[model samples]
Target: MDHAELTTEQVLNRDIPWETYMTTKLITGTCLQLLRRYDKRSESYRSQLLDDDGPAYVQVFVGILRDIFKEETVEYVLALIDEMLTANPKRARLFHDSSLVDKDIYEPFLRLLWKSNWFIQAKSCKILALIVSARPKPQDGSAANGEASNSKRKITTIGDVLKGLVEWLCAQLKKPSHPSRGIPTAINCLATLLKEPVVRSSFVQLDGVKLLVPLISPASTQQSIQLLYETCLCIWLLSYYEPAIEYLATSRALPRLIEVVKSSTKEKVVRVVVLTLRNLLSKGTFGAQMVDLGLPQIVQSLKAQAWSDEDLLEGLNQLEEGLKDNIKKLSSFDKYKQEVLLGHLDWSPMHKDPIFWRENITNFEENDFQILRVLITILDTSSDPRALAVACFDISQFVQQHPAGRVIVTDLKAKERVMKLMDHESAEVTKNALLCIQRLFLGAKYASFLQA
Candidate 1:
């Protein structure tokens, strides 16, 4: 007996209940048949089936079909499509035509999952995110016709619905699970939905930045981290439109961003951090404000990172463009310089005076020694106390490292200055002088003289 031959009443009155039939693969297969029939220009089958109700019925039937198709017979699948297209063209058009209107019919199931249990809700969010993200984007300079007319310029109600759903999803993610699935799906959904400015703004308004901050680390799964990257990108967009900077700076985002920037793994996360910083600093004078609020820590981190000088150079270059006259403040390392340099022993600046003094202490007889001697002659002509201190320290460390270079350090004037710096206010210079003193005693064969 043909399954379609059974009347709705007969079907409802059968040994199985309507709920069972509605859920079974038979009904799902039947609906897909009806939908495909409608796709093929068969109006009569669609009318017969769709006459049961409006969009809500169509939605319920579609949802049921989604539930049942996995178990249905192949023959039933073919017949249902044939019936639906024969019955109603408009209803068939929903599937045959891949457009925003078609997506409308399928989106409700995702929305419905908001009220479902954990696993179902997570799956629904993933599916919905896929649908939303996969929707056709508008083209440039295309005719403002067809689906464009249906797709309004304003933000859709869909974004609001999605935002609320994601908020609920994120709340559930606070729990530990048998398998951690909810967060990844929810983040994917959030990323997809956030493609819209309105959706992105909604997330920002709902403290989404704070929620996303915790998820930015590479410790999270790759997909989860990618979702985080997308979320950060979304936040980057929001940074310009809303008070996102205020939120990012105040919330956990700033620290997480700094951590990612400093992390040895995850350069992509670091790239996003750079972008987020760029956005935060976009307001010109506001960029300088970051210097006080943990910016120093971030800079300190960059200084210690493997690419310290390169990253610092880029960052300082950015700051210089933004601050113009006040850029010199960044180069001042009076407090952190010694520590940073100790950690980065290979760091050698291009400044001729420091470089010349460094090379002189290493090998004054080398080719560059003439240039170094000339620089030393010029330095001897100046009496700037700071200049004298730096030149003395540079030569002192070089000579200490290479015993042959102590010839340059034995100058009485340089010795007096080094002794003065031993009591210098800066602990860094004083530490260096103490170090040089030990080297001076060791190199001079004056061990007993030092004891005296």
Candidate 2:
């Protein structure tokens, strides 16, 4: 059977030779007795044994993983550990018990991450993530659980463990070992791990943020939707970290997220994407981007739905309000500044609104004519005819509205760039370039008449 096809239930049904392992001194007598009691037992029976001697079972399992090289034994032990943690994740803390302080519990699982088949690798990644997360945080160079005496012993540092796990997870995302389950498993673990600041930093440092953008789409199947949900969950968690947010701002993450939220009917998917949008809405130019993506209408549409998740409803409301405020802000100078600075010029209403120019014209002079300089640069460098045309129009508007409009435009050497566009192929570009020249040479008074 393919190791990737092995399930926990299938692996658990195997009868292992615990007595043989004990006879060979591979496992202690105590470990044999524990395994006998644990193997083939009812779920309740196993739960009771673990509840009574959870750390001992953890120790035995880690010992077998560290010492045993048999694939069957390793797979069996990992299944046992996986089942144990899956039943009660709080049992993960057993691996960090004060009694096991000297043991390198993380080493075995971290080693298994790269050594074994898909089943072993996947289980190892999951178990490692659980135990590492459940470990007592260190303080004053001591374990928080009072396991400080073994601090001098060589053990796997949490930093090394997390870094290893992140690397493995990223590898899985980049190229899955298991055809169907690998990416989902990686994303699932990341959704849990990214709550840690170190994980977030490591993920961003490894360029893991881009790996997630491709997964942030609407999913139809139950499995794919869950993957999408968890993927977005990872993104939602990342939204709080500033460095990840910086990466997200530049990537297609916003548009992809907006697309998911716009089309997804699943409330959980909608909820998470909305929360991410709300987090990013306040940072940098995300608000403007969200408005540009038409998120306000999406938010309104979402609010009309009868979502049961309180957080989802609350997020939709907050996003709606934020988008509303963003719309108002976009209608003002901030929107124009964002458009110009980003060099994505278009024939938005701001370009033709005389009132918009009359009000915000002098505001452009505040940044050493930074807005005007970018427009001129756009004329020189931009290949998008709409951008070139809009740049010409905006320069013409600046000349028409600002008090030193003509002097400022000419002194910035924008006249040559605008003249260069006058003979361009795109009529929009040429017409706007001619209008700009008229405003520059003919002054705003005569230019206004021509515009009329």
Candidate 3:
């Protein structure tokens, strides 16, 4: 019985009575230890588990967990759940099977997931998503009423799960630390849950639309940006659900999305925002929301900007293609002017329309110039090559207008930095800087100081 002499096979196959050894202490320490060690060396364990000649040890070891959860002991059940989640994939795969899932175990499983330490909570949420997704659908019997009744029951179950998950999800997202882990895990869980039609129906039923504002809000961390995007993607998928599109339109998400599109400095964030915009706008309900949020100006800027960053630009183009039909919504905002002026301006696909000058530019009497000044200040001091490039591009577009250029030239100190950027290594920077230089000299006539 010496530990070093015992192989995993011997340990697994050597069964002690569950009643004797599966008490609270044994469940927390010894059982968890086995699950951890097996999972830690998962590849090796899996190699053995999946092999045709593999020993029967894994099945026996897994049976311990099965027996533990069934022991009518809450302590043992919670500990077993933790062990399965923290255990390596090789060991965890044993628990992944649907045989372990049941209505009685479902709610407790969720409670354990929601309350676990942050590191393991991610895996816990994923497990819950899988369990809900795999729940059996009711039979499609010959009785017409049977199908309807089954559908209603399925919908009801999905609603309960969605509400529970969302309630837990909101609390998790509010945590200040480790959004990098929490957000993506939540997003993946949401994505997985969407696989079932009943779940999709429940997603709409559960006020998921209202949940999106916080997901995409400025209060969110940089870590949550992609997570927010993925949630937006979830909303995009749910766009087809009954009344969901209308719900999203009424919710604050679309305006927030437009703000992210207009204001985000990160290229990846912008790419995601635009793509989500495209997806939402493709549908009539959400498309109107985009228009109300000033979709025309944003789309115009995006189309004109060169966005030479291939990966980022490619993402933006994909978003554009997704919303290609919705481009019509942008027409009345001065389609002719933006096309005639910016048809040739090479800029990031993430930029807004330049033609707002003629129509809305003159009417900026109520607009906040403080933000514009702050943007100029940021562009002057920023060292990030990508950000500097975007700043230069935006400033140049703003200055292209005859009156605006003259006004900006008097106030915006762009010449000093454009010269410094002559030494920049990034093509996006050089390209954007060169455009700024061209505009500075061409219309504003600041070339003398730039040359000096």
Best by lDDT: 2
Q: Model 3: how far is 253 from its true place, Å?
A: 1.4
- Global lDDT of each candidate: 0.48, 0.87, 0.52
At residue 261, candidate 1 shows an lDDT of: 60
Encode model 3's per-residue lDDT on 16-64: one tens digit a residue. 4443554544444545545444433545564554343222333334344
Determine which window of 10 residues in candidate 1 has minimal summed lDDT.
334-343
Candidate 1 regions exceeding 4 Å error are 1-107, 136-156, 173-179, 217-231, 284-286, 289-452
The CA lDDT at 260 in model 2 is: 94
lDDT winner between 1 and 2, please give it: 2
Candidates in descending TM-score order: 2, 1, 3
* Overall local distance difference test of candidate 3: 0.52
For residues 1-452, write the lDDT of model 1, one tens digit per residue. 43323332332232323335545544555545544444334445546545654443344444553444332322232233323433443444333133234334344434445543443344345444544444444663332112333444432345545665656655654542314555665665665566577666666666666777777664466766676676566555656665656676666665565556655255555555665666667554445444423344455555455544454457645643543333335433321232222222222442224444444343444544442343344234534445444454444545544455566656533555566667767665566567566666577454224321
The residue-level lDDT of candidate 1 at 186 comes to 62
State every prediction's TM-score relative to the real structure.
0.48, 0.73, 0.48
